[model samples]
Target chain A: MAAGNEEISLPASARRLLPPFAAAPFGPLLTLSLRSLARRRPGLFERLGEHSTARFLIDPTDLSFAFSVVPDGASAVVRVTGKSGSAPSDVVIRGPLLTLLGVLDGTLDGDAMFFHRAIAVTGKTEAVVALRNAIEDAELRPSDLLGLRGVLARLADAGILGGLSAARHFAADAPVAKAGQA
Target chain B: MSGRMELVCPAGTPATLRAAVLAGADAVYCGFRDETNARNFPGLNFSPQEMAEGIRFAHGNGSKALVAINTFARAENTDLWRKAADTAAVCGADAVIAADIAVLDHMANNHPRTRLHLSVQAAAATPEAISFYAQAFGVRRVVLPRVLSVQEIAVLNRAIDVETEAFVFGGLCVMMEGRCHLSSYATGKSPNLNGVCSPPEAVSYVEDAEGTTARLAGFTIDRFGAGEPAGYPTLCKGRFTAGDKTGYLFEDPVSLNAGSMIVALKSAGVTALKIEGRQRGKGYVTEVVRAFRRAVDAAESGGDPVEIDGILAGLSEGGRQTTGAYRKTWR
Candidate 1:
């Protein structure tokens, strides 16, 4: 398991290319979130194995957050976590934080929450919301970020984003959009 | 296409069951008035005696009765579902409609001779998912999700072995059935487990300073003027705000009327046309079933589909009807 406190120095070129926020808050946030997530290495691995099935997990460390997709019957786990502050050595997140992470990842939707109410946070609602927004902004595709490289191969014929953007656009406006726009 | 497509109808009570069968339903589906079925309303569904009698009555009239045991079974309380399966099998129903995997396994294991139809509550929208169920549990027919177009249905028909049943009229569900969690969020009970969504107990209507807002479990679903008809309070049809806009984000309050698409459905290889209003009165059931029976018979006899435009207009929800997902152009 990767330790959060492990010093990872970026290349000089990478540092220069990073946005100011990425260096200041975003970098630390990502590092902390990753390290915290890594602390739950076994659970994260378990979730990753079941990504195609229905099980989900959310991990929120002190400075960052993460989620894992565990396959239903598989032995392996796949995890994806991100944060907004300095990376820590070890971290733990509440169950609610884990569920919210699944929602932002698009693995879960509003209707799912509306129906199940699977995740509920107790302490800091705004922090969870912020974490959700940051993860959405990151736009990390599960196939790419997670070690589901073979899953991406199956979907390769469908194109890079697999018509996600077009579908979103269509869902937002659809047939009524043209008439409404006029 | 071939013969007249079967008009499969819903009957919440024995009265409605008899009415639908006599009015022209080739088949009627009902459930035990318990949590085992989706329409677990207070007065709806059948008693075991009613179910046995309903089956005998339908059979005597050359019609079939299907028992719906469609609710998802809890992990520990599998006995309730097993008992429902046993009762349906004992009642001599033509088929038992089920959704839960464990329940399906139970039926297959216990009553291997009994026919199983996949309930719409399974939400098996894709061919792969549907095939998975059919292969696993010997599901003879699948009541497909309402999301597919006629073309999609045709394509699926070519791939799967089982017959397909589809909604041709009555209430419209905006999201996938069985998978919906909206009702559970507002109220603790859900369709998957409790077999009721937006239950009457949790629904309330109040005329406030703004308007008459229909609420489900205290959350506003829709608001109507004094003159406008207030629709049922379901979580999906509720008016809510998302980024400042406040309106129906899921679907407008409307019933489905596929009267004009009888020919298209026949061409698409749909074996059964389902009418969905178990909570309605016998008159509504008789009228709708009779109209559809006439339409289907006419179309089968190489005649044009019968038109009951004015009669049906009065029965529609809010006096509005949509073709729903049948016509791809709606998407």
Candidate 2:
């Protein structure tokens, strides 16, 4: 598990009832997904490699983890980096996991997110642009990961989905309940 | 009253351009891949080939494609703007939307036949500025800034010889289009130059046991409580600590949705209703353009405006909508 991962408010029910499981590192997960994608779309990786002239470091702010992504031949490689506070990179993207998922899913507007400051980029702007363009062109998603659904199903069987709903309800009601009490 | 007002929509990619055209957008505006246009975001806009293809697709669908080379050109990089204008003209763009004086001059001198429209980034709110652009660069229309009211727009239209476009929907820029520099103050890049505001790379959202706080360049812009929906940390829309209160000082985190005022806006002499959000996707372009098309047709035929209300709520920012400065109460 990523360091400081416990601090992030996962859906409320999950926090109360679910026990933490050992999650895999983000790098291996990303790499496996990218390799599968490259195999499916050979030209896409080449185009991405051409555009990704600089390296990128993605930081999930809620977790104590970061990743370095660089183009290698026709495919890109992702490696687990330690943290944002120490690692130096050409471009750095820091945001919440939900926002990252939203971007990958194409449901969230990256520009609007930037405008809102939910996602941030620092270092060379060109590198971030290249990465963004490549990602959008490739249209990768968290669901695109191999066997992700199976993993999710196992988690759901553990009452993860119910926990999420309970957390959401708790979050939605806490403020109103406090006001009512006051 | 005899003619229907043009419904101009935004197109970030060729797919969205095609979607807008099919959805009944009379004209679609897009920018080049670089910082030449205001909506310079990652994975958005078009390349030269994509622009040509987009133009072809739009024209085939009986719609026009307007290329936006709207950003201000640096003295050293004047050729980049010139090349973009040249490309737009060659690509058969119906119009080239520009804000810079130099870029306009280049378009006027070289591609005299290609129509020119003054960008809202110019912040040309008065007849004098509009007339100046019209006379100097043969500008056919002006995309008026967000500052003017419907009544003021009607008055200005009577004075200016050129056509006027007003924003009817999408994201709201609380500051004047071209003048705001809050992003530059925090990030090193300005919208006028880099074509980004509160750029993504400079933003970070910190979540803890208490809540989530949105930060821009290390400065905390807004803090969200446990259940509150955290919005983007745009400088203008940020909550700040005042003497005794802490709240949004400049603007709220809501989208502009003026579907209800289509008739009043048309009556105010607005020639066109421009929908912003060039950085949006085909789904957004299709939904917004289709709804606005129905709304415009309805308004022109003296029908109800509420027809589009329900369709737009899901797309609004933070699920909240406003008429913005168009309504006097918003002032």
Candidate 3:
């Protein structure tokens, strides 16, 4: 077991709950993130062809990559290499992409993947807008494994999602509770 | 034996651009409305057409216009940045202020005649890094990061061939520019790449049964009581619990007020003094530029440092100020 695992375990009720799509270890999230990437691959290829100088250096397994886009938000170059070796071929991506590959590949967290740095960019500023629009437009919602309304709804039902709420309530109500007793 | 230091001023609009020029700014820096500049806030910065007009107006008054295209360029979007650079060149800008290495490389290669001023966003705080940019891209000037003291500035000025610009007054950024990840941790955007830090979009205020708290990207950064003045929610200035103490760990919400340090800065051999705040209004631009202009003029005339206390008190952040790293204070 990991160092902290001994301190915590799934409650009997929580254990009976089905894992969400992304919470089922890495398998489903990886597949979903990859599927999202594959869906956008055609657009990526078209964007890559538009820029002569743009290139991407990605470590899909490690989630580190460098990419360059053309001056116009039309084409890009992406290289995803292994830790020790060069990339296979400088893959191309279209302008303004969310680039789910990093999150799927476990190189980046969900937040970082959605945020700016996960998709390291160099070149034009409009490409950022385009990329943001594309990703947001995709609305890559995390899968609802048990067909719950949403990720939050499922997590709330599972009883594991309220740690922050408990922590916040404890921090806020501790003093109030003490005063009430006094 | 120090050469006459240049005094750079900010101009948010064309009128302020004229005000800065008429007030005796050696050069005026402004940015286009898009993400090309660090001050990407709405209602601030000039449109491309306005930038052309501002550049013309400044040049007409015998002052130079330095276009700030300092934000880090996004990958696969090089065209916008390239066009920004090209536009500045065509608009007769005296120089292009940039922070990214790739942007510098592009400018140096494509527009060889256009002067390049390295923005503070590069965080080239060390002599070696400044020297490296100078050697690599022939950068004419480097806007030194806000982490250096007067003595350090003198030492750095000696080591590098490029001219150095140091902030004299206005907002203070505690973290090393171009190096901080705190903003990215909270907001998806960062100043280095996105030209914004602790962006307004990611901020929220929650007044619960306990107290009023400011949250950034769902993390409670600061909490305020009813009487205390609530400040803009920046990650560094926010109150947080680190260990037993729940207070500002990084820095207080204070603007940098360096009006009293003009003599030290002049003696330190800084080539230019930059005033930060491009989001400020025209009145702010007028007052600050006027005050600094008087101080610089007084210093040049061998007069006592001009008193500019009343002029800029209204424009300070949280109505509080500090000399920042210029004075070595433990707190």
Candidate 4:
């Protein structure tokens, strides 16, 4: 269990190559994105939240960041919690970067990653399962974690963001993007 | 594809129902919003209002709408099943596709005029079981489980009086349709009971230096190597070490594409051809329904069935396909 508070200084060379806007507030961005998703598919989180007040600690092992996700009514609240050897969470998930990306893109089977030990989870199993179901029901993507589709699309049009533009095209052909409240 | 063979399609939502109907589905089947049907994933299925509207739309287009109340009723929660049936009848559904004997009995007694079609979840493969359902519940049709071959189906059809429906495409269940308890053993949820298999909640994926792994309830079901596509980690499709060799012990990650067997199934006296995957989206429903419509029509017209092999390949599980037990020489 890597401590969240462990000081991780990026290499100077890596820092120089990083995107200038990479330091943006992911916590607020993710919260706003979740709100947007909840708006599109109302009752998605509500059904998943059913009587459970779960706090999830998501650790992307390949990254230097971790976050806590708490479902609040129809939307989820995201916080960049400290790794200060804090109290155990209701659910904890640790997985590689590619694994997380694959799950988000619907290209990787989450269960398969767990089977191969590429992903790991602990604590209240039911709560974790519920959250996973809620997310899978959403058929989410990495871009969905940021509520900047219009900006990204514009950037894509100007050849500034190739990946986001490709995603724009993908969304056009994407299946009806919702699971029912039923 | 015989002139009399009905093409039964799946609908996960109201839009899909319309897509299926407009694509020439003779009949479309769907479930109530909850666990009353097998494809009970979140964000899928029709509400009572949606069900009524979808049925009305299908009926307006001269297509029949069947309501699936197919999951087994818990000992303490039979009312849910009963309510689903009553609602279906009120919605004027052409039939109620059911698996539970209690549900069948309730539908027969409470909504006598509402036709009952036995769900594949019943796993009623033999004439005796089919006859029992027909006699006990007046079930007019049975969606035969996926374990039977074309020859076996023809034989069973001859011995049974009820109309038989067989799967022609989509997800393939390795075990006897309703009898398998693999998911329950691994995840504490069964398709027969909860109407979910490899439930999304119980499923998780992890990645490490080795590769990606699929897990169910903490048990590793399968692992994918670098750049390899990962399939859903249902217990039956998982790779396991059997003896000294490791492989898909029960079945592979391929989906059932019985497109090539439309003529054989029709010749076997199958009253209907079922295309699975109600958990899918409208794009899937639209493409599959339209393609199968062409295939069924061609078969009925005594011409070559449409060449839709690659058309559905992208939509298949793990991007591969099989005929399943339809031509089971492996057995």
Candidate 5:
């Protein structure tokens, strides 16, 4: 297992090619929102059950970075990195950002995506299965998962989501943005 | 001909139920979101509220809904299964497909008007077993296990008075449906007990440059090469090495495509043709039910049902399909 604490130093040339989202505050905001959502619904963690400790790598193929999550139900941690880069994970789910969001929001059927081979899944299937079930069982949309409320929730569903729908247009070396309560 | 054989479809969720109904299924089978049914997978099955909605939807569309309370009841929680049957009856489901005697007894005694259809899990292929269930529980229909031949089914249907249902499509279980313990041995989950085989929590799939490998409980089920289609990793379909050759020891990763035999099955006195996969989604339900509806409708006039075979080829497991024991090609 690769250590999360292991230092990753990128050369100036390598750094130039990285996605700008990797340098933004979106990662920390995602982590905080996840923790807040866990507080809102501990059942999400309860659903993960035996796979609570497992690390999941959610790779949105349209985005250059991936989110690594350990939804421990309490103090859950979600981290976004430019690349997984061999950091060991219990499971890895790779698919289009829209599809991933659709699954997260309970709009897409995970089994159907799997059958159509729209998503590439690997590693500890138990955890992946549990995670997918947890998400769908909660029926949470991006607003819910992000703990976005009221007008912000509306923005999440429309403005932010609409912007993300065009995430492909974002610079390959984009920087992070946003922060939230954990 | 006894007219068009009923096209019984699987409805794993509320969405799938509507899809099946709109696609021309004569009937759709589903279960509560509990161990009372054989397809007790996570995020699958319906709530009582959902079940009511599904039943109403099916009814409005001229499709019947069959609730499956098929799993063998655990002694401690027998009432849970009974409650499911009662709920199904209250929801006015067309029938309850059940296997457990206690569940059957409860439905028979408590909800006398609720029709009973013996689930395949009961493995009641013999004349005596089928008759006993019918006599004791007033079982009106029986979903036959997948192991029997068409000839064997034709013979058995003659000895029985009730309607017979056969699995004409979807994933094949090599073992007697109710008797499989392979998943229990490996992952402590059994279809009859927990209503799962090679449960999602115990299965793994690793894809890499070498293609993909599926495993259950740390045991490798099968390894697929690049460009090869993958199937769900059930133990019965796993590849194993015997004395010399290494291959699928029990059965290959092939789907049971009995479309061509819709006429033969009707001739065998089969009342329904079941398309298994309650754990599947709306896309699968719509596509499969449509193809089968065409086949069953065509078979009404003794027309060939093979023309629609092309539509089903891509939907099969591992992109491979077989007639199973229907043709008895192995014999």
Candidate 6:
């Protein structure tokens, strides 16, 4: 398990209910996902243009661990760590796990999320914008990360669907942010 | 009796166009992918094929599409602007909004049948200037610049022959329409020239204990305290020090929410009420258009003004609302 995960105000009933799964290493799956996406859309990272060299810290606030992704086309790897893991990423995108997933999968608007304060970002706005543009164009779904058709894909998909209610589960316990609250 | 104001909305993409139509816009305006139209962000505009499809969608849903061929034509690339105008005409755009004299001349001489609306980028604030466009090019309507007060617009409307459109909501530029040099000075790309003020590539936010610092092209624009609503540091909204005091020297980082002035604007003989932010997402487009739809309807039916100052609170940059120059004459 990652150390020093930022403590959000989720209720005891919803917090860390997926103890075993939360402990499961997500780096390999994320790495696989990025590789699959790069393979399917060759120009995905190239669209990042000058921002290709920047490292991104993707923080899923509902989860215990965060991820650092160094996007370099097919060779990209995702490192799962705590919020305080890195010194300086080109950008830091923090939000509920499912919403972040939704943004990546093009199911949600990152701008709307940012506007609603559902997402908090710091660091290079250009890199964040580039990532958003690249992700929107690539049109990758969460299940696309697996690239499998058998039982493993089914299991991953089930987990992905279950993650939605679980995200709301965490959110329901947290204090509601006010209108235009940052 | 006051005539019902036409609701003009912005659509950056085809999905947004459909959203605006479904939500309640009488018209939606968009741009081509090239710089011939403004709001030329990467992956944000429509192509010729997409424009044709979007226009068809708007028309099918009882909405009109206004193609923005608004950017001034480069001396060497005048044909590019003409081609965009040609594509807009070919696609059967309800109107082509243009600013440059060459473009207006091209539209008048070449596509004589197509309707012409003067873009706010033209900054034709006077009856004389507006009369020149109306008489010379047969421009049917002119989008008034944001610099005018509601009273000034009321007075100007009676003197001009053409219809007038006024901005009701969304982003505000303190500059004279798109005539901004600060963006060019900082990033070397003017909204007038390149269609992007504080171009995304030139923007960055750095977070330390001092809080978030918004920068434009490596120059510090502003800093926000922890948990403060951070705003994009456009040159106009950035706080600066003048004469030993630090503050928003030009204007504060607040969005224009002119809902209260809807009835007043209608009384001022405004033909259309516009919502800005073509580069906004479908969700943004949907919510704002719907809220203003009710507001506009209320103004028509003699109901409440919809008190929309707080409706757009979450979506607005800096999370603050203002009546803007519509009420207060900053000049």
The RMSD of every model to the true structure, in order and in angstroms, is 23.5, 7.4, 18.1, 8.5, 7.7, 5.6
**Model 5 deviation from native, Cα RMSD in Å:** 7.7
lDDT ranking from best to worst?
6, 5, 4, 2, 1, 3
Q: Specify the poorest-scoring 10-residue window by lDDT in model 4 chain B.
A: B224-233
Q: What lDDT score belongs to each candidate, Candidate 1 first?
A: 0.66, 0.73, 0.62, 0.74, 0.77, 0.78
The digit string of per-residue lDDT tens for model 4 on B199-233 reads 87777666567866778888888887754655656
Please tell me how candidate 3 rates in CAPRI terms.
Answer: incorrect
Chain B only: TM-score of model 1? 0.96
Ranking by TM-score: 6, 5, 2, 4, 1, 3
lDDT by residue (B1-331, candidate 1, tens digit) is 3556889998876767887899999999999868999987654677788799999999999999999999999887888888899999999989899999988998898888888999999999788998999899999999988888999999988888888998988888859889899999999999889988877667655545564666777787777663454444687877788897888788887788888888888898888899998765555677789999988888788797698655565556655678889887945
Report how far off residue A20 is in candidate 6 (Å).
9.5
Model 2 Cα lDDT, one tens digit per residue, A57-122: 777654445678775533667887666757667777876544554555454555455544456665
| Predicted structure 3: lDDT | 0.62
TM-score of chain B of 4: 0.96
Docking class of 2: incorrect
TM-score of chain B of each: 0.96, 0.96, 0.93, 0.96, 0.97, 0.96
Specify the poorest-scoring 10-residue window by lDDT in model 4 chain A.
Answer: A1-10
Off by over 4 Å in 5: A1-55, A60-63, A68-80, A85-90, A95-118, A130-182, B207-209, B301-306
DockQ measured for candidate 6 = 0.23
lDDT tens digits by residue: candidate 1, A1-182: 00110111222332234333333453344434444444433323221221223323344321223444332222324345443122231112232322333344443331123222232222222222323322322333534333345757447524534454343333323322111112
| Residue ranges of candidate 3 with Cα displaced over 4 Å | A1-182, B206-212, B242-244
Better of 5 and 6 by lDDT: 6
Of candidates 5 and 3, the better by lDDT: 5
Better of 1 and 5 by TM-score: 5
Question: Tens-digit lDDT track for model 3 on A12-43?
Answer: 23322422232334434333444445444433
In candidate 4, what are the lDDT values of residues A1-182, reduced to their tens digit? Answer: 11111112222333333332452477787778777766766655653545236777877553445777777644578876543135356677875433454445444444444433455666555566555545544545444554446778455434523453344344334332111110
